[model samples]
Target chain A: MADKKTKNVFKKGAISSDFIGTSIAKHQSKTTIGAHNIFLGQVRADVIDNKTVAAIEYTAYEDMANEKFHAIREATFKKFDLTCMHIYHSLGTVKAGEICLFVFASSPKRKIVFKAIEYIVEAIKADVPVFGKEIFEDETHQWKVNK
Target chain B: MTINVKYFGLIAEITTCEKERILFTKKNVSEFLELLYLKYPSLKNKDFQVAQNQELVSQDALISGHELALLPPFAGG
Candidate 1:
């Protein structure tokens, strides 16, 4: 069994394009990986009740969140044939239009990668104990809920 | 026995603290929740779930783990 100890999936803030680029560039050496699908979750400036969101402050039960991520990763591996996977989420404040979550999956075939990406993302949304407080431009806030 | 209860999100706002340690007996989670509601009546109407040792648990489940958390709905991507 793979060590199931929690793996930290959180970065301190918004995921940078440079970091994502570097991640993809490093995978070039893995010639066996024929398909790589990526999911990037960007924060949206949602307007509600005449308030426009400016940013989001995210928090999580860190220990539990990491454990859940590990479990999800293992489940994805068991359900699909894949070469590698990477998941990342942001902690603290992330502005609207910034990337907050990133999931990357690689496999030998295109079909597996496509299905695996959606599965992994939905699992993260429902299972992880992360919370987001959306801050509006006027300093009001609201808790976010996944649909 | 004494257990540590951690609160998150709006629950923390109601409790005015992130965590607290309290004395408890060996019983089902529902009973423990009753005690919590007595202490923080505002929590009685709040929507949340219980996690024992980092696992989502039912109210009928036994309370064994030292770490217990009150979690609100998740909103992650």
Candidate 2:
């Protein structure tokens, strides 16, 4: 069935503030949620070899990445008291200081949302197979590695 | 066997293609990797993990199914 493919978490470019705001607004109808914690991963202007980073071009092994996202989502729900969760990542180019990842977790209480967001973000950094190519201001590039 | 191999990110840059159907004579992971290194010598110097049917497998394990992937270090946020 269609559900077997898992929900695609990738967006075409940088995640706009408008889209994020709209997502939050849509949750107003669900009166059960009392707290929401969001983590936005912004691209840093990293300076390497005296060159400053201008942007990052991202790519992934789509099939495997999707599966991993699904697993992470499932695990987060199992371990936390979450009412809902949503994650979005950028594909293609995202400029320095732009948002590339957005993780939103909501719960009935503030404490649970805080813990849930951190866990999900850390799991994503360590487990997902997404690659980032850092493009320098001079147009040269190098691969990005999370520490 | 005709093994379907997929390369992502930096690995794909070296291989010059995203996917290929390689004519593999070997059955185990090490032999298959050796054969790949023969075809693309630069790949031997790169860092990656091998996935068999979407699961990471050790070099000593046997290759199963038709699909395999070369995944570089994860840089996801």
Candidate 3:
């Protein structure tokens, strides 16, 4: 359980281009800060044992994923002093070499934004309850759950 | 008693189905897992976690005739 005083700032489900763009625009303010660091995680077509990955299909236990995402968001805010932060992860099918996650953090200083971005990305990858299915070029598929 | 159990990731592959109803006398999550491991010996070394009613729980948590989901660690961007 998280502390009641913390605020939840994450949105679950497949993130669309519009949502990503809008979140950035909304978080941009004159009084906020001077620097914003963004981390975009794009899927890659990796050759695994002579087989190239074609696409990745993502699935989630919705209720649990949402809870976990909220917890992560709150924890991130507590760990860093930032104006705002946003995390979006793809939920359905994402092709190789396409964007899968977009993380944005803004702060008054450039140094803080850089450190916050790194921390957020690491936490999301290590804690969130999201799964990916890797499809090979030949159409063979493999589920990729985090280690 | 029979309880519904759900599987995810590699565990799903071994069970060949994502969900099932198993009849067992186990009273806690750990005992249930021990029974499952006996039935599916291949799951001995696989990494997984348990959740009851969508809330993550420790292996020693008490669970009886409740909906539970087994999830492998997440691998998403």
Number of backbone collisions per candidate: 0, 0, 1
Better of 1 and 3 by TM-score: 1
User: Which residues of candidate 3, in runs, are more than 4 Å off?
Assistant: A1-19, A145-147, B21-24, B37-41
Worst lDDT run of 10 residues, candidate 1 chain A, spans: A1-10
For lDDT, candidate 2 versus 3, the one ahead is 2
Q: What is the TM-score of chain B in candidate 1?
A: 0.96
Which segments of model 2 are wrong by more than 4 Å? A1-5
- Point out where model 1 deviates above 4 Å: A1-5
TM-score of 2: 0.96
Chain B fold agreement for model 2, TM-score: 0.96
TM-score of 3: 0.81
lDDT of 3 by residue, A1-147 (tens): 223343333334345678778877775554656788989888788898899998888777766666776777777778877877766777777887777888888777898889888888888777767778888999988778555
Among these predicted structures, which one has the highest DockQ? 1
Q: Which DockQ values do the candidates obtain, in the order shown?
A: 0.88, 0.85, 0.64
Candidate 1: RMSD over Cα atoms?
Answer: 1.7
Model 2, residue A30: distance off in Å is 1.1
Using all chains and alpha carbons, the TM-scores for the candidates as numbered come to: 0.96, 0.96, 0.81
